[model samples]
Target chain A: GAGVSQSPSNKVTEKGKDVELRCDPISGHTALYWYRQSLGQGLEFLIYFQGNSAPDKSGLPSDRFSAERTGGSVSTLTIQRTQQEDSAVYLCASSLPLRDRGRAFFGQGTRLTVV
Target chain B: SQQGEEDPQALSIQEGENATMNCSYKTSINNLQWYRQNSGRGLVHLILIRSNEREKHSGRLRVTLDTSKKSSSLLITASRAADTASYFCATADSNTGNQFYFGTGTSLTVIP
Candidate 1:
């Protein structure tokens, strides 16, 4: 792909329902990351995947937030039992490798709004 | 725990003026990167400075890193109205599997 791509540019879900956000990173990139950003707030790191290694799940806000990367190419961020407070823009990025500098390419983020 | 913090939450300047934004982080970083976001989403990588390097430049952008003080700054020279956007700084720590922590961002508005 030309760059990182995220689906469902905007998502509006009701409280208690679950929502899934998707990200397709640039081909051959071995590192992927997910971040949540509230309006006018700093980005919150959620999860990260580096190659076939176990994901770094330390940043997941809660159990409700989980992510899976299959084939190390595409990723899915699922929010179980969504809450109003979860309303924010979810950003996905990919880099060449785990040690690559801060040159990650970001996607156009999926705006998730829980009503 | 967010490692990076940017100053002058908002900045306004006329086109052709120079805009400088400062970022301070509280950890050992291998590199620091600056990004620009327009319309609240999609960020474009502007420049990256390795910790070992003191300064780097790319076109209209100049970046400086002070490892001892754990701070970095981005200078946009002769800025244009198209440069109006929110700028963010991200710090990458190698020991942490290259995880990055981003700052709240400095909103730059270059008026025509």
Candidate 2:
């Protein structure tokens, strides 16, 4: 339980439905990240959360993608009106603040499948 | 957009051989990190090499960074069957707010 933990390791959703993936970071890490990896593809940056600063939504693919971190520890990535293209392995990572080097610890990830 | 791109999309070698993967980035980076992922699993952090560092080693993993070339490499020595996985290089740019962009990755298969 020392590393990042993700719930519902796999989820299947109907197209147009909503899905929320959860991530629990290592207790003291202040920087959390969300990324997606499509089948046979590389990881894609989604959003970033760091210690109360504004969440970086720059990498979000569309308005349907959103994420929030509460109390700087647990985070959730929500996708509304999901399309087939939204299917991917959603990964969460946490690390010491950006200042303490960029090493990150990752969770098992939630594999989201939209049909 | 992805900032890093890896070369030789896939590699296969016999156990006890060495495996190397290279990555090239488009922008200046503060640090580059290597990660490994077995099929259907989350990424496992391998090693990180800062821009200021030329080379770093961790166990059987060795990472090297070349700021001038805007590239990095990860080397795994004495590969094993369990080493079969995908390897990716992520870059943290100098002023990109510390958000890391990942590379396409190289799928490595170390056969016994």
Candidate 3:
């Protein structure tokens, strides 16, 4: 892909339902990140996946929020038992290996609205 | 808690004026990069400055980093209405350089 790609640009799910957002990073990139942003706010780090390393999950707001990256290329962010507070834009980014000091390229985010 | 915080949450300026935004982080960083977002969607990478480098320039953008203070600033010269957008700063931790944290963005409105 020419840039990072995300699926289901907009999602509106009932509260208590589960929704999954997907991200496909650029080929050969070794790092991926997920972030959530509320209306008019800065991005909140959600999770980070580095090549073959344990993901940094410190930023997940709660146990209901989880994400996984498969084959070092695609990632899925799952929000279980979603609440109204879960409404926000989910952004995914990918970068080159850390050794290369690469800047992140972002995808057109998924806007999730839990009603 | 590792997130960086940008100052002046919102700014408004006239075209041709310089716009400056500051960011401060808590820990040491291997490098810092700036991004611009429009319409609250995807962000575009603007500039990156390694920890060892004090300053870098790209077109009308100038970035400066001070490791000792764990802070960085982005300056846009001769701004235009098209430059209006939210700007964010991200840092890669020096320890692992894998954890990338973004700051609350500074929204700049360039009035023509």
Candidate 4:
């Protein structure tokens, strides 16, 4: 893909339901990141995947939130038993390898609304 | 907690005036990047300055990084209404280059 791509631009799920958001990064990029943002608020780091190394899951809000990157090209963020407070835009970004001075390119985020 | 903190939560300026936003981070960083978001959607990368570099320029955007103060500033010269957006600063930790943290952004409104 020419740019990072995220699927299901908008999602509305009932509380307690599970939701999954997908991201497809640009080809050859070695780093990917997930972030959550509320209405007009700043981005909150979720997780980071770098090459074949272990992912940094330090930013996941709770045990209900989890993500996985497959084949280093696509990633899925899953939220179990979603709550109303989980409503926000989930943004995904991909960048060049860290050794090459990674500069992030973002995708149109997935806006999740838990009713 | 966010590594960076941006100054002036919101700013309003007339078009053609210069707008400057400041960002401060706590830990050592490999680089700092500025991003702009419109309509609460995806962010567009504006400029990046490395730890060793003090300043960089791209068209009307100028970025300065002061490692000593762990601070950076973005200046937009001759701003236009199209420039109205929310600006954020992100830092890549020196210890973990892949870990990126973003600060509370500065909302800029340029009046035409």
TM-score for each predicted model, relative to the true structure: 0.97, 0.96, 0.97, 0.98
| Shift in Å, residue A10, candidate 1 | 0.8
| Tens-place lDDT digits, model 2, residues A42-112 | 98889999998898898999999999998988999999999999999999999886556858899999999
Tens-place lDDT per residue, model 1, B1-112, is 6568999899999999999999999888888999999988988999888889999999999999999999999999999999999999999885774578899899999999
Best by TM-score: 4
What lDDT tens digits, residue by residue, belong to model 2 across residues B27-50?
Answer: 777788899998857999888888
Error of 1 at A92 (Å): 0.4
- lDDT by residue (A17-78, candidate 4, tens digit) is 99999999999998999999999889999999999999999999999999999998899999
Q: How much DockQ does model 2 earn?
A: 0.75
- Could you tell which candidate, 3 or 4, scores higher by TM-score? 4
Better of 1 and 3 by DockQ: 3
TM-score of 4: 0.98
lDDT of 1 by residue, A1-115 (tens): 9999999999999999999999999998899999999998878899989989899998999999999999989999999999999999999999976475537899999999999
Clashes of 2: 0
Displacement of the residue B44 alpha carbon in candidate 1, Å: 0.5
lDDT of each: 0.92, 0.90, 0.93, 0.93
Candidate 1: segments with Cα more than 4 A from true spot: none
Chain A alone, model 3, TM-score?
Answer: 0.98
Local accuracy of candidate 3 as per-residue lDDT tens digits, A15-92? 999999999999998899999999999999889998999998988999999999998889999999999999999999
